[model samples]
Target chain A: MEIQYILEIIGTVVFAMSGALAASERDQEQDWFGAAFIGFVTAIGGGSLRDIMLGSYPLVWIQDVTLLYIIIGAVVLSGVFYKWLLKLRRTFLLFDTMGISIFTIVGMEKALSLGASPEIAAIMGMFSAVMGGVIRDILTNEVPVLFRQEVYASACLVGAAFYLGLDYLEVERNTNFISSVLLIACIRLIAVKYNLSLPKFNRQQRQP
Target chain B: MEIQYILEIIGTVVFAMSGALAASERDQEQDWFGAAFIGFVTAIGGGSLRDIMLGSYPLVWIQDVTLLYIIIGAVVLSGVFYKWLLKLRRTFLLFDTMGISIFTIVGMEKALSLGASPEIAAIMGMFSAVMGGVIRDILTNEVPVLFRQEVYASACLVGAAFYLGLDYLEVERNTNFISSVLLIACIRLIAVKYNLSLPKFNRQQRQP
Candidate 1:
């Protein structure tokens, strides 16, 4: 439990930094408040949506004020390290990938604990990993990268299915958790490294 | 209670139509499925967010399957009347205005019932009224019209405040409901007719 909590904290911090970086890089006119707001949303949006869908109360952040301060600190630190962070784009992507992996497992576990079906849990898990970026893209007035990017949500989904399958076989909890997270992270990294992407929907060729 | 239910149904239908129309008018390549999906999100996004925030269980649409069919019907009808709907833009705007007003009061009352504070309730009301459109704008890859448009959200806020004040003053519930909804509708219609809007935040003049 303690390890899970620490992992969640790390994921939240990384997500916050990514969000701040995204906002800062998007528009020259964006102010500190704008960056911070976007960062906060990007970090919390996915989990909040998952909790809401699962009918959980006193959202994770609301339950722990420490998480709020952590997010604030993360956002501010991102702002302070703005140029340095931008220069370390590869490192940032690594952390973002790790964050998504952690969030996916966390969300899937939470939904399962809430008695949600495996299918719903799997979908919610992917949503937990990706919806923040999706909301961030929406806020930034761009098509969600989830819809266009290489092997993001699908990676989460595949990892979730693996976890569920292992759990059904009575695998040890921590082993299942770590293995699933690693699987997602590896898939995302490989996809990005290889410049792999799903085929796009051919809008023009589709029957109208 | 029956009257409120009827009003909510009306609001849902109008919101669904607006969403479908928005999707259809935005991109020529948008297919029927795309338009319906966008419409469903736009119609349910605000209310679902509000319910989640308030820790309300069994989301409105989830509990009432009838609402699902209603939204689908509304979306399909909008597609069928696509050309006519565009031509009757003014009429559509009026319905949208009416939809916002009804959603505001309904959201505020629900928040109050869920034991939220007046301030949260008021803000949630505004959110319920405008968030669907905000989400729609986001999905459509536009800056939320809420941030740029006329006195739309502000009108909802004002009307929510009026409803709360009336409730405090022990006004009859039905009277308070009708009056607040009308107040919001009027304010919105007037704002649109006169092309009035709040002042924009001057990003350049501020300190970095």
Candidate 2:
């Protein structure tokens, strides 16, 4: 329970920071309201959607109102440290990878507990990890990171798959959680370090 | 129930057309798969989100699989008549307005039936009518209409308010639905005709 609590807080803050950074990058032309709203959406958007799809009631945030405050704090923190964060792009990206790695396990566990198939659970994990950025990019007027050549969804899927595999093998919960998170984070870090990406989709216009 | 079914079908077609047109306009470089997926998201995105938030199960589409076929049909129809639809921008916009109008009533009714307050019901109505376009714009990499100075959410709010008013007055259900839908459609048409728009949020860079 303590570890679960720690993971939740870490995931929440990191996702909030990622959202705030994303908003600052895109919404310099807008005000604090825009920035804060965008950050809020990015942090909770994916999990909220996943919860809804799974027919969970009152929403997770509604159950624990402090998450909203955490997101608000992240928005202000990003605003205050805008210059520093921009300089630490790689650092934040690492944090983002870690955050999403946590999200994948949390999301998958929630889905499985809800009686969803492992396949659906994996998709939900991916959704929970990436949907925030998807919504944020849409709000800021850009193609989502997942839709691009980034090894984004693939990382989440790999992590979710590993977690499911471990669960099937009767691995202890905390051990399974930590292993899956590390694997996802490691994969993501390697992908970024190598400038690795998925092949571009055959489309009408190549991404500039 | 018969009338509700008719409205659902009509709303589906209009939304599908709106989504298809939106995709063709913005994602032309993408292929049929892109367009179809975008259209599908736009048509069902809002109501689906609304349903999820309300803790409704199976989702509307899962409960009635026919909706998927209709969306597919709409995608194909839009693709075939891409040129013709392009030329009839006003007509398509009208259809979109109608789609949102119907969506407003349907969403509000659902929320109210779930024992939501009238105020919350109004918001659900607005969300159901507009979130589809919001998601579509995000996927296609554009700012949502609501975020900009569009009369979009306002029109839905007005329709939702009218619906609640009629309900409070104990008006017949069919009459209330019809009247609210007409009002929303008319408001949207007039807004477009007159180039009416909401004031931009006081921002660092106003939208040009």
Candidate 3:
């Protein structure tokens, strides 16, 4: 199996868990259907948008029922360990960071393979890393974390650029892949630990 | 020109206006870029989702850059008349209603032409009519109007079903088209005027 394919599978599982955890955290109790729906969407939202934007057909979940099953299993596990999982905030962060890093590389590669310009592929990578969380935040009626303070999508974009640069330099594929993922994860983790954030737009404050 | 084609252009314009209006209504005064971005997304979001799901290639906006220009034009107009537009809530509602009705039929027809099943086509129609607004609301950090009190997407779904049934019975194409659009519009207007809504899922209320 291709290394990218393995990363994608890992990303899918972590995304599913992240989504389920988010659903469970909402004030309103989600029934099985609601939890499962959110989980499925959160796992697939970014990649589906990337595919759709790229005009790639047969959505990943639609083409592979196994992914659907995996999402369901993740949701079930979340429900079973709801309390324990909620207490594991650090664990949730770890999985989410891992998910984004893996998805960024996978999405960038997919876009490149489909002949998208490097710039466009880098954007696709960022979209894949963060759009799922954005959609999840939207569904839960929260301002998307993407728009909030802290290095999030920026981390993905920087990692994607690094990966592209390394590839351009003809680095070994495995070394490039592993380093790119680690770069994103480390950037995100360090940013969060240090409370670092990108500057907000300095729009003049006007009374509503 | 086909009547549906005409209606679609009209829908596009109105949807763009609706999106710009929504962005303007947010508490923060949006800069031109912010307003234009929201307008563009609200104009194309539903149709794009439907096309993507159906594996339709070359997204409408991408295939015809004219739509992008139109959305930008609408955004500029909205900015010019922001205060005046805000005061004309009924005008906004009228345009929004018209936009959804037209988009519903256009999306359903597009899906059917692409060989989607009637059930799936109906869903695509609802997505077309309401997903833009849903996305707009999400971006603005509100629970979507579709989930709030009032028949929104439901009205679109009913009209889509009515159109399909009429087609099944060999009704004249123009007649079916006009009637379906009118049906959705009337249902939506009446439901909003009378403050009607679908029943909420009566999940047991649990203390958070």
Candidate 4:
């Protein structure tokens, strides 16, 4: 199997787990349907949007029925292991980072294939990486983490920039792809570990 | 010129005003950028999603560009006449209902043209009718109106069904289209005027 295909599967599984975890962590009383729906949305929403915007028909999930099965399996596992998984916050973070990194690369490649300029490709990549989490947040009635002080979308942007920069330099396709993914995952993980975030746009207080 | 084209333009302008009204209603001091962005999102979000899902490339906004100017103009007008517009709540309601109704027919027709089944067409119609408000609500940090107590999405569904049934019965295309739009808009207007809504899934009764 192609490396891209392998990474895509891994990304889907990890993303699905993160989505289910978000639900379970918030309220353990959440039912199976809610958990499954959120997980499914997190796993596929981003890529589906990119495909739709790029005019790729039938959607990835429709074309590859395996993603549905995988999401269901992950949701079930997350539910069964919620007790033990509750202690694995670091594991979830690692997987979330991995998932977004893969998503960024895949989205950039898809956009380029669709004849988008490098700038537009980067944007599509970031959208493809972050939109799923945004949707999950909205469905669960929370302000999207994307809008909050997180190094999330920025990480995807940097990865996309790296990919485009490398491609412009005539670098090997596989090398550029792997490097970009690693850069994004590492940046996201490090930012979280160090409590780094973008500056907020809060209005200044006036002196009394 | 096709009636559909005229209705689409009217829908865009009315929806844009609603979005601007949402912004201006919240923070009186909100700048132009926020109003413009929200209006743009409201004006095109649903159709863009339906188009993307149906593999319509370049998106409607990109295809026409007129939608952007119209939305921006509406937002500015809403801002300038904020006080006057505020008292025209009924007017806003009428236009919003009309906008979503037209959107329902347009989305259903687009899906059918893309070779989707009637069931899927109905679904797309509802999606296109409500997804804009859903997006606006999420961006503004509120739970979606569709998910709350309103007969909104149900109205769209019934109208889509009506359109499909009429077409199946060999009704004229224009008749089927006009009837669907009027039915959805009327259902929505009546529901709001009569204070009708879906039963809430509230876990507990409100304390007196």
Error of 2 at A158 (Å): 2.1
Off by over 4 Å in 3: A1-48, A57-133, A139-141, A146-208, B194-208
TM-scores of the models, in the order given: 0.60, 0.60, 0.60, 0.61
Candidate 2 error regions (>4 Å)? A26-28, A52-58, A147-149, A197-208, B1-48, B56-142, B150-208
Q: Comparing 2 and 4 by DockQ, which wins?
A: 2
- Tens digit of lDDT per residue, candidate 4, span B1-208? 3778989989998888887777455543344545555677788889888887776678877556566677878887887787788789878888889988999999999899989999999999988888988888887787787877379999999999999999999999998899999999899989988988777668687699
Model 2, global lDDT: 0.82
Candidates in order have lDDT scores of 0.86, 0.82, 0.83, 0.82
Candidate 3 chain A has its poorest 10 consecutive residues by lDDT at A197-206
Stretches of candidate 1 exceeding 4 Å from the true structure: A62-66, A197-208, B1-48, B57-133, B139-141, B146-208
Local accuracy of candidate 3 as per-residue lDDT tens digits, B79-139: 7777787789778887789899989988999999999999999999999989998888887
Top DockQ prediction, candidate number:
2
Decoy 4 TM-score against native: 0.61
> What are the per-residue Cα lDDT tens digits for candidate 1 across A19-112?
7777455544454545665677899889989988887887776556677678889987887777788789899889999999999999999999
Best by TM-score: 4
Off by over 4 Å in 4: A202-208, B1-44, B50-55, B61-134, B143-208
Which prediction has more favorable lDDT, 1 or 3?
Answer: 1
Predicted candidate 1 versus true structure: per-residue lDDT over B1-208, tens digit per residue: 9999999999999988888888556655678887898889989999998887878878999999999999999988988888999889899889999999999999999988887767668868987988998888877877876645658888998899999999999999999999999999999999899997653211233355
